[model samples]
Target chain A: MTAHPLHVPPGPVDLDAIATDATPGYGGSKSDGKAALEGLGPELADLQERLFAEGRATGSRRRVLLVLQGMDTSGKGGTLRHTVGLVDPQGVRISSFKAPTADELAHDFLWRIRRAVPAPGYLGVFDRSHYEDVLIARVNELAAPEEIERRYDAINEFERELVEDGTVVLKCLLHISKDEQRERLLARLDNPEKYWKYEPGDIDARARWDDYRAAYELALERTNTAHAPWHVVPSDRKWFRNLAVGTLLLDALRGLDLGWPAADFDVDAERARLLASEAST
Target chain B: MTAHPLHVPPGPVDLDAIATDATPGYGGSKSDGKAALEGLGPELADLQERLFAEGRATGSRRRVLLVLQGMDTSGKGGTLRHTVGLVDPQGVRISSFKAPTADELAHDFLWRIRRAVPAPGYLGVFDRSHYEDVLIARVNELAAPEEIERRYDAINEFERELVEDGTVVLKCLLHISKDEQRERLLARLDNPEKYWKYEPGDIDARARWDDYRAAYELALERTNTAHAPWHVVPSDRKWFRNLAVGTLLLDALRGLDLGWPAADFDVDAERARLLASEAST
Candidate 1:
């Protein structure tokens, strides 16, 4: 219920103003942060199960959507592996958006995203979500400037509809420095195990870092809503990033005030039926 | 690859003949088995990443399909939580099939099953699969006797096509006894946290335990092939069940002989470009 320290406040957004290595709310060594994340498993799992139960038993539409956006190698994949991995996979619905296909391009940008929305009682995660329409689409001049302007309003309205329909949208921008990204890209090229992650086009994107940052600043400012606030996650330190995101998710779930759904069937009757059936067997 | 001890051999599979509490391959205490499963994390994660990388880099059709079929509360969901949870969720596509809708029923049973198959380089998991058509349909006469008879061959052919097209189907029958089912169902009833899982219909299914067992025995025998053999996992103990399924998945991934996919681009040239870009910035 309290304000999250990492929540991007309403203002003119500046990517350069925030330090990427700052562990804003958490004060711990890497091991301490890791252990804290591990400790959160039980509570997070229980709350998630309760949410899942509420949806199934009562057909409640309440759900959570975690939208992750960042530059290449900003640890979207790592966030999924460590932080999001804490909950039961069955309760999570993850969709990674790549370049749109022919069919996707033919329709509105939100067309594909709508199809991937989490069903009732799911923790939906979008890695490189519809934000791409404004980010990459803006940086590359893939769409007209006026059209790009229109999309910001379109996205805000779409997200508002989701919130009204019992969805909690948690948007996180995995903020990292250019220096950190350079190091990570080099490391990927250095290690054979990580080589599969490196693509030449990543350099092309990196070259336009300033343009991407400007694009992000505009997008974050234009689309930042009270209902679906964006959190700028400082992701230079992997451990802290995971801890922050995990805490953010934990807080969002706690806000829901989820509890075990009450039994719909008569407990005594079910018990009697079970015993009678056992005896007959 | 060495033969897995829990694999059902080519012959009649007597559900009564197999002891439900037996932990055939695991030689450890509950904590030890849990630790052993945990020990598999790094290796399992690496292999899964490689499988995912191969799919992305080369457009390789090689994939895995882990089909889990069992009575309710047979630890299918547990296996997913503890075992499949070890892998990167990005690479794992899980589909849990419930009762078919009017649209689903209008088509062949395999039609829905086919739509949920894993894409290239994915670890696909089905909580309950097409085998349900034979199991439940046969038990309740949901289909005509002749139609149920025809589905056995249809399933075999469908699976064979998946295998031939580069899917390694790992079918697991989570074997548990009638007594075990009663205890599990009772546990669900007693615990408020688990009450959501206790449907009254589960008792009805338990009442016809013998018929369900017979259905499983025949289904396993008819569909078991060299390419996709059934592993009868003794799932009475939750810890051992998690370990056995983890080991099965690890062995299946190891059998793929996966490695870091070769870089599709010139690494040195990209590295040079990266450094040059950094200098410009």
Candidate 2:
């Protein structure tokens, strides 16, 4: 019997939904995200227990890759910090990709990223991912028009390969408005404590805000494959973003159907016997 | 008034304690380690909070370095994992030094390590540290006699400088008996799940344990200075090792009288106002 490979659709993301101007009020009052997260928390806790137990019992673990891509100041770090809080460190890994090394830039765009994938039974969080090709590379005019075209195809194929091999790909694009970004940037500048978060370069990026939005739209349209659909999250509301992202992560992890390996012994019975032995001794 | 620095010591480490057989029953009973950790938790938590709050408020966060050196089966990772749990991530950092990379080896021994120093108001944990000059460099016969001498002097001076500049340096040497190590090694080999943790090369190292001991003894004798004292922990008991190490770290952090930076405004009082604004809107 021949094995069936996973299939992916090549389609552009519906940009209208992503860029919707509905002033749904930041972190909606109705609490859909919160309600969803409450349901997801126990599932995440269970998954974490199973994952760690299996890792220790079997000595083999599955790896998870959570890729986050978004506009500047889109709370990527915040999301990462919160997401990891749910899982065990023994089975989790995080890598934040900043500027590529000279060696990294010399190779194909995906080369450096592919090397950082987590081993099985582990979770790897990518702050910015291969989509850098479609974001920073486009914004800074670092690559030629044709190079960008090649990269989009390469990323799709690369993600497909990871998913086919039991790697779960969960990607999020944090959505925030230009005005909201301006306010946040101002807040960073106004607060002496947050001054470290701001850079003069950020202002230059802000000036090209329209360009970034158009670039993001194109990226979502061109690279949002079925195996890895981009979740456009409304992130003006911090609590809502956390709730939404946390719920999505919990759901994705639960869907993997992770379970503890069969025990080497009946732990309860053995534990009781060990306790009795100690008592007698 | 003539400005003068504090009467600082030659090195941060306490050399006197290094050579002593500090732990009589290391690896003997795991319960001892658990008790030590229990006593340390609150102290560590308090210090971590103070340091993190100071860092966030003042932005002049001091750096802390805890260096762990041990034999193959000793509990460096366990010590670090437990210690890190006591501190906030925003206020702590950990780096496990593996064998030198080609780029690392090309520079001075401390080049790679120096970069791993935590930012201000942060704790940096080194799984193993520059003591490799005396430990592995001596064991593996990597450095020339003169070069090794220079490193020891350099390490002493470097650590002294860090302490003078407000970096706290705490070093621990986890000491386990040969018989205890052998049993732990055997357990690793016997447990199929833990087999991966055992390397055939460890057996080779076990054979040369005497040489490693000599190197460690020499490291303690020469490099342990007044500012940094090497706490030789009994690690035959993994739980006890964790506890002793945690206690040591908590003590170091608590010794530093960290407090909140002078607030320009009453932020907590303002919190209610901010929430009210959100509610009114």
Best by TM-score: 1
In model 2, state the lDDT of residue A274: 28
The CA lDDT of each predicted structure is: 0.88, 0.66
Which lDDT tens digits does candidate 2 get at residues A1-281? 11111112346444434442332333445365456545555667568656655554565645568888776687887776555654544445566677788999999889989887776666677879888888888989989989998888888899898888667788777777666766676675456555545454555676676677778878877777888777777777665676667766776777878764654544444333323331110
TM-score of each: 0.95, 0.64
Regions of candidate 2 where Cα sits further than 4 Å from its true position: A1-10, A14-63, A71-74, A86-93, A97-123, A129-169, A175-213, A226-229, A233-281, B1-61, B88-93, B99-122, B140-147, B157-167, B237-240, B251-281
Q: Lowest summed lDDT over 10 consecutive residues: which window, candidate 2 chain B?
A: B1-10
Residue A29's lDDT in candidate 1: 81
Interface RMSD of 1: 1.9
Please write out the lDDT profile of model 1 over residues A72-113, one tens digit for every residue: 999999988887788899888888899999999999999999
Candidate 2 lDDT tens digits, B1-281? 11111122344433233322334434434555466566566667667766755655565747678888888778776666665665434345666677898899899998987887766677777878899877789888898988987888889888887888778898878777766666666665556445545555566676676778777767776776887766677666566567666766766676887654554454454333333332210
Which regions of candidate 1 are displaced past 4 Å? A1-5, A279-281, B1-5, B279-281
Recovery fraction of native interface contacts for candidate 1:
0.59
Cα lDDT, model 1, residue A225 = 97
- Name the lDDT value of residue B239 in candidate 2: 66
Provide per-model DockQ scores: 0.60, 0.07
